[model samples]
Target: MTAMPTRGAGERLWIGTFLVLGSLTAFGPLAIDLYLPAMPDLARVLGTSDSLAQLTISTCLVGLAVGQLVAGPLSDRVGRRWPLLIGVILFTITSVLCALSTSIWVLLVLRLLQGLCGAAGVVIARAIVRDMFEGHRTAKAFSHLMLITGVAPIVAPLLGGQILRFTDWRGLFVGLGAISVLILLGCVLVLRETHPPHLRQRGGAAGTFLSLRGLLADPVFRGYLIIGGLQSASLFTYISMSSFVLRQEYGVSPQGFSLVFAVNAVGLVLGSQVNGALVSRFGPERLLTVQLVMMCVAAAGVVGAALADAGLVVLLVPLWIVMVGMGGMGANTTALALIPYGHAAGSASALIGTSQFLVGAAVAPLASLVGTDSRVMGATIALATVLSLVALWRVHHARRTTPAHSEPLTTTT
Candidate 1:
């Protein structure tokens, strides 16, 4: 765990780094969602209400948000490898705990441990990518990562649905436990420590906390994280409420609802591909602005439809548009946030990732109050879009002293 001598990201390391890190990044989402279909069954088995069962999910997210802040800085000190190994072990143990839990409380606590370990994959992967690539290359690498990681959401739920038919809910956790083992094997064999000893600060926790202070103090950094967070909320809000709105309110079968969800995944893939192209040409600022505008317009349309009592098509169209905008904005804004901190990529990625998910967790509860009307989806999208526009303006305004046309993100992480 002692810091090793620092080394640059050599060309030979590029392909290995990209593939290893991308797979590592896929660990968390796949673990979380692959078991989600078992939630209702889990609730019944544990003798808990649906609301209490769902709180287990929120607790996992809470663990992710808080754990990443600690993990990022620790990675800076002890190096990326050990924290990652330890996290993998913890996650594996937690998955077993989840599978064996006799009560809802035990399951919820184990879920939090799973979230804690999740910080390793998401935070460290971003840091490693930032360590090696700068500007356009960094963005492109992330695009590739998203392309692979995107498959989790597209496929995990369906896989979960299938698994549920054949096995008990405990099997869901067992499957996830196997995924943890594979993730650890990948890391042990494929991922080398990218944070060289010399490149790290020696200030320990104080040094780490100060690095965070510096990032938070920067208006441009805060702006990018806030904007990215809002975009996440846009997507998660739908996820939080989708079943109730589509199945209960609209009288659709769960199978039918899953089909509709599958249709939206295509939009995400298309947007990620478009983002890699658009960012290089128009730059992150202009691209984010365009998407932010599109999102607001989409939100307005959906909201209007909801208020006017229009049909599902009215809602579906705007929802797709919103998804497309989210696909565009998430990567671009993350690039912007990390652009300034290539040297401290771990901390930067942690801040952005935590901000994005925490904001999402904070807003997603609105679904409980809204009662599955189209207004639930419409209102969530509108609010997230509004945050995006505001954050975009703040980023622009913070850069006013420099030339607006000058691309600050071109050379750095």
Candidate 2:
């Protein structure tokens, strides 16, 4: 593996820039987590089954995935600011519409649109980081962003649960719309165009397809994508099921579930911060290997606890460990994947985000099938962990076996 040259001191990100970017990174999480507490109530209010209500989440995940595929390359071609502006505006509109929805089907459609537009913030934030940073610095920046993104999972759910005491689920969408408005103002004021006109890809749709094809050809990138997608599957399994499992099975209240959710989110915060601190010294690949192993072990423990029908304490312990491992590895895999694609950072970031949510969309429902018992969710997560390990192994193997003339596995010193 070759070492990438360190970025110059002059290229340092300003505190203001970091905050605006962090806000952008929080869009997807805010949209997803804020409404989680309302999902059961949503089912009853909308006159639908729990499984059908969960489909609302899956639909949003699909929208996030598909939206990134569109927004990323479009941003690369049209520049980041305009696409982002349009996305947030549309997202706000969709969120408002979602609040007005009385039917579960209508809500599902609106949520999909909301995810599609909100995806601009999620994908473009990473593209901007890749635009300015490289190697370990990129990873570190992402970890820092996770400080805010991780907080969304913590604060959004707790806030939602609290809000439920006063208003219903519709209020959550209204809140999301209001939040998007603030993010839009931040983008309009703080974010400058990162991709210069001279650097833009000019081949149009044909060119975008070609660029995607080129990225897909890289073994390292593919491996990292698989690793990321599967890791997300593990986490989304938890996210999509935790509300029901804790509330129905363990007889916990919405507020109690929110506290549990927040505690696990803290694991993400701690993991990301630790990864940021250690990534420069240990390198991303090494850290990723360790995280994958940790996730596998923790996921196995989750399965064990589930099978034993152990107490919530036993279950949460290993579940939190899995979240921590996911937090630590998420940045590393993304940074590693995008290292060689700086020229097409938007498209690359899009693919990474898409892979994650797409896999998440697929797994959410499967986990929902057996989520009442926790056994199926645990087994599903365990399977994802194993696949992630296999993906990481392929990344390592590809680095060793690729031709001398091919792109070398590189990291910033």
Candidate 3:
């Protein structure tokens, strides 16, 4: 009997895994943003209140949360390939239903299904990364994957905006169905099974929950998780509320708003790419420290801008700076947190995504409370900054208390 080649085999596995999985992960942002431009129009057509119409988005979030639970463990049990294929097929079906929806409630249910479908891509993508790389390499690889996923927000809305010009918001769903089908085909042709069946039998759901408890009990993981969750919430809050903020408060049109949205998203790619280059030399811990501080500075600036009644451009400049740092923090934080766990990648991935979405879902209501101004949005930004900084400290504290012989940083998680 021949044992598998370890080091040489591992890197090759990682490279192949991320290439396909990264595209799947990118679909999450695409699903969320693809029809965003038509939200107002969709609400009017469906004869629903704007708030109720927005429930479609919320439904999707709920679905993603629910689906992650299913996909994470299922991946562990049956391997990654089948569950992902099924998810894509469901995503494709529901997307068609969404395009045909006549009422907000109908769309809501379909949106939930869409979210569940999308969740598989993200949860499995992370699990695959953990399958191959940990420590610095894990963090670095996350950055690269983040780079791949980051493209969705940039291109999706633009594409959606153009489509809305020709057809009703329903057309966006049609396009999504088409995109999902194409993506599914790409994955079928290219994506290999990364979570081999034999590698994960002993550590079933019970084992996964236990591993999760251990990670949760650790302050370093808690801090990183909190920062990750809060930062995600902060961005979701902005995206959710941007239309009202611009149209009502700043007096921008919907078309104009999409451009603004695209511009802000540019910061995502910028921050992510820079983080990729910097993490190797600086390390995630050190890089996060600086990024956290800058995020706070940006938050403080946003608050001051709202208070001082500064122009939108003035406030957004600081925000751009903050997101640039956030791009780096996003990947580094996950890698650092996961680096210690090898046996529970699926559960870990599930927990992290669930936490991020829950926090984001909770924070989304702030848009309603704050009522279309810089006020609540600014508070959300500050909240993310404060939490991320605290998380960095907790991670640092943990490093001091526990020191043990560990695997290669490349295989830490």
Candidate 4:
């Protein structure tokens, strides 16, 4: 069932396929990160309160989470290519509308639309990979896609800041629109219909619901989902609070913080590439076990560093290891979670994406409610990784205890 490299022969075609899929994976990150530097400017231009301006981000996050639930199932129903093409085209149009927005309310609506449309790329790209590859090869493909998602956070803000120096917030939206247009071209050029008519699901809404319920009932799949969701919870907590913690607690300059952020991102990238190289040798299950344990230890160290009022270097060292663990675990968990659901890869991918965001969104503010300080951030991250480890243990235990014949199976139409 593996996909041949798209539209041509040899090594170059494979590279092109990877690039297009990687670009698809970048949609959510690009939409969120690319305009972050312009938040204050956006607030001022629209004559809105800072809190209201912040709502734009929240709205977009909501859109991303909800949109996947729709787009993923839709892709399964109709086949992958047209949903993706239409979604990207609509996303581009929405980005243009966002750029033209003069009111906060209007901009918020447009951002939400952008997230909904852009979500097609995020979910369907993973679905397409699952449609093509299996086992360790699936893990490898995901790791490469993760390279783009991992790099986006690092590059987008810096690039956005530079864009701000040249033009206003509206210009940033225009830039986003341009980026999507390029992705749209890539989609049209490289992507083929991986989910064909014979393989496509029928029964419409009822089928989608049944597919989701069946996936949820499988303990192995559910465990992987929980593992991924909690890992993302830890990562997002760091993302939400790290700048403030580093600046306020350690007296780091903005430039110093950016350097530290980039360093951590590079660690993440390194871990992902390494995981891809090792998965074939070590296996995703074994690799996942080791990575989660490492993350648990490193996350606990972050709590210790925060409590002891340690040096900045001490705190950062553990954080970097956690980032690395996150990088490795993401592809592994996703690859494993999706292995059993090729018939519903879109739905499975959608659940994975949605759960990560929903769980992160839920947990991040709880940490904030406690405090935005280093101690709270560290504890939240530690708690998340520990929970992830527990979920992994539970998964293994269930597998060992449950009879093979009784294990739940995903029903494919």
Top of the candidates by lDDT: 4
Quantify all predictions' global Cα lDDT against the true fold.
0.77, 0.84, 0.77, 0.87
Worst 10 residues of 4 by lDDT: 404-413
RMSD (CA, Å), each prediction: 3.1, 4.1, 3.5, 3.7
Q: Estimate each model's TM-score.
A: 0.91, 0.88, 0.88, 0.95
TM-score between model 3 and native: 0.88
lDDT of 3: 0.77
Give the alpha carbon lDDT tens digit for every residue of 207-239 in model 4.
999999988987878999999999888888999
For model 1, the superposed segments whose C-alpha errors exceed 4 Å read 1-19, 402-407, 410-413
Off by over 4 Å in 4: 1-13, 403-413
Which of the numbered candidates is closest to the native, going by highest TM-score? 4
lDDT of 3 by residue, 19-101 (tens): 67777887677788888889999999999999998778778888888788778777777777788889888999999999888
lDDT of predicted model 2: 0.84
The TM-score of candidate 4 is: 0.95
Give candidate 3 misplaced runs (Cα > 4 Å). Answer: 1-19, 44-47, 100-103, 203-205, 244-247, 252-256, 403-413
Look at candidate 4 and give me any clashing residue pairs: none
